[model samples]
Target: MDPKSVRYISECFVQPQYAPEESKQPFYLSPWDLAMFSVHYIQKGLLFTKPPPADEQENFIGGLLDRLKSSLSLTLVHFYPLSGRLSTRKEENPPTYLVFVDCNNSPGAKFIHAALDMTVSDILSPTYVPVVVQSFFDHDRALNHDGHTRPLLSIQVTELIDGVFIGCSLNHAIGDGTSFWNFFKAWSEIFQAHGNEACISQPPVHKRWFPDGYGPIINLPFTHQDEFVIRYEAPQLIERIFHFTSESIAKIKARANSEYNTKKISSFQSLSALVWRSITRVRRLPPETTTSCRLAINNRSRMEPPLSPDYFGNAIQTVRGIATAGELQEHDLGWAAWKLHEAVLNHTDKKVRGFVDEWLQSPFIYQLGQFFDPLSVMMGSSPRFNKYGNEFGLGKAVALRSGYANKFDGKVSSYPGREGGGSIDLEVCLPEASMHALESDGEFMASVSSSN
Candidate 1:
């Protein structure tokens, strides 16, 4: 189908069904949230076969849209902060900006109804991700900072001839992958129960996590937008989803462990090591060139006084495992996985506290493209997230896809496979040539059971 085939039907702000008086106060952003102020918005989407046909197709679509929008409103009651916009106040002395969620105004989240003339196979069976899929999202080239004016969360429900795609554009400053999926799960629960609040088993915790002595509002050094150098322009690349079956992942983990003579190698670490090595080799960088794999680690349970699993905000840190290209290429998969395992193990509670302390002392924001080197890989989004568990009445999601928000060469997003049982689907973005080379590499293709 043509990329422009997606047509918008309706758009509006989806407010909470009932906003508590406490939600009227400005929601303070934590240091973790402020650090991601300039990063790209988190864009994720789910695909499901169309609900059982109705007498009139247009009426069916209308009914589906109403159900989604209404359930979203009820979900927002618990996630009220998502309905708010980012607010900022500038101080002159040192040229600082105080950023927080303006919950008082509650601008509300954006809900869009769109239609696409395509089949489920057109998306699930594609060799490379369809460019038109990017159009499903609300904000194409937006950053989290755009939340100041735009909705902190935007949901676009695109009706397909044979399927439906529910896309979300969430401000990264407000939450991470964990928080994003939790909100989605809650919405799906409400929608599945025909908009019943009793369906929600565990409500999300809206209280933001902050280090002691730190604040609900964090200050940034930048006085003007020009001072921030975040660019959404990504290098030309091809994106593909590689799926590893449960058995394949087990084989990979066993191989890594056997090679390293240890049983501690995890499935994720092994998988990460394989991708890192393959990408580095495909790039064919200099032997001495330094290549790193940055892993986004969740700090909820790692904190001294561990934060709740339901904490609804950014609580992640990107920890990097470094090695030279020569070393990585020469070493076995077990060696590389061990390095990543060590990196993850080493991020102890003390280290988490140290990072918070350092950030509190000298607050600095992350600039887009600075998180990974040109030859590095950044693995984000966890396979542990229950992607397929979101059954919005029709059935479970058949496929998971991401958008053009924070994409870059070597950026990988992991999702739980549709078949589950410890399987993983990695959405890999890489330059055209590098992607071509990766597809031909036998060592990498061996672990990948399928790709699209």
Candidate 2:
């Protein structure tokens, strides 16, 4: 059966086993957190094959969900923010508002058990990502700000015919990809420990990071919800995961370095250049038209004092490498890669602070087309995340997939290949016609491996 024909078995809230006394106070969202209010939740999931036997499948699923819920409850003891909801305060002078997470009366994270009549191959075998994959996640259209009324964290464990898909929708306002994965790893650790919380190597540092003289509570200029709550309707596009082997990435990096006469060109820069150039060539835009590749930088280590790696909440800034369509097509891959390298290297601590200062001076929400226009690309979700290391006792995940939230033209998500060893999977989203063109482009397809 189609994946959309999913049957939801049960829904329940899994609260923390022990709520700390400090959690009674509202958790103030920093400027970094507020900046993500308009963005969608981080919808990522893992795929696993080899489910229990058909005869014992019902009991197996029930026991699995119960264990997951119990482990999640234990995990939330430290990640209590996930159980909180967004709250607002009406400020009078200057007519603005304040947003914070009211952690006092915790509603807990939503745990949903669902089943779909599909196999693991139904998802991994497709050239283009299946549209029905969106159904595996809860809060399909929710923004990070929706945490006010909706659950901040929602997980859907969907049982397939021969596999299981663990899909999670975490409000972006609460954290970034780093925090999301940290929470996931910790939860899996607790689960694998069989309720032994001592297995957690390092508890997350929930203390939010803030620059000196900045704030624990940031104020926004929007007086009305409509001014900040903008809906994102993605354009007609197709998403395809292009797998690049470790050897291919090295070759691309080598080619870029050879042309540039420098070994400083990183693999990521080379890959970004290749895609940017390839897409520009296929688009055939006017000579003077400008194209950009927006790269999201993790600011944890980039800060002056350096934030804790486990510091929960958003600490990211986007840097764009802009070039004319003709310039990209006319120049060599090394040239484009150099442009991206300069952009990344120049985003120092001063630049990161400058970005926050500028945003603070004039607060605004990010729209879907804000940085990722049809002619521009936005690269997010790094390949360095522990995609396959997440072991839930069922063995490593077969694949990593994301949901429909925040997907737009020119949006590209990077993941580590299943085989690891520096391999990468680029989940590229482009307009239907452009995707067709990309598939037929031999030069681009040459680096992509046959297997995903």
Across residues 1-452, which tens digit of lDDT does each residue of candidate 2 receive? 55457888889998989988767898988788888888899999999876446446557777878899999999988899998889999877788699988877657899999988888898889788888789899998898888999999999999888888999999999999999999999999999999998788768888887767877878788787888788888998888999999999999999999999999989999999999888888888998999998888899898888888888888887888999999998889999999999999998999988887888889877766564688887889999988788877678899999999889988899999999999999999999999989888887999888643
Predictions in order: lDDT: 0.88, 0.87
List candidate 2 segments past 4 Å from native. 1-4, 51-57
Please identify model 1 stretches exceeding 4 Å from their true place: 1-4, 52-57
| TM-score result, candidate 2 | 0.97
* Per-model tally of clashing residue pairs: 0, 0
Q: What is the lDDT of residue 216 in candidate 2?
A: 82
Model 1: weakest 10-residue lDDT segment is 50-59
Which tens-of-lDDT digit does each residue in 276-370 have in candidate 1? 99999999999999999989999998887898889999999988789999999889999999999999999888998899889888888787777
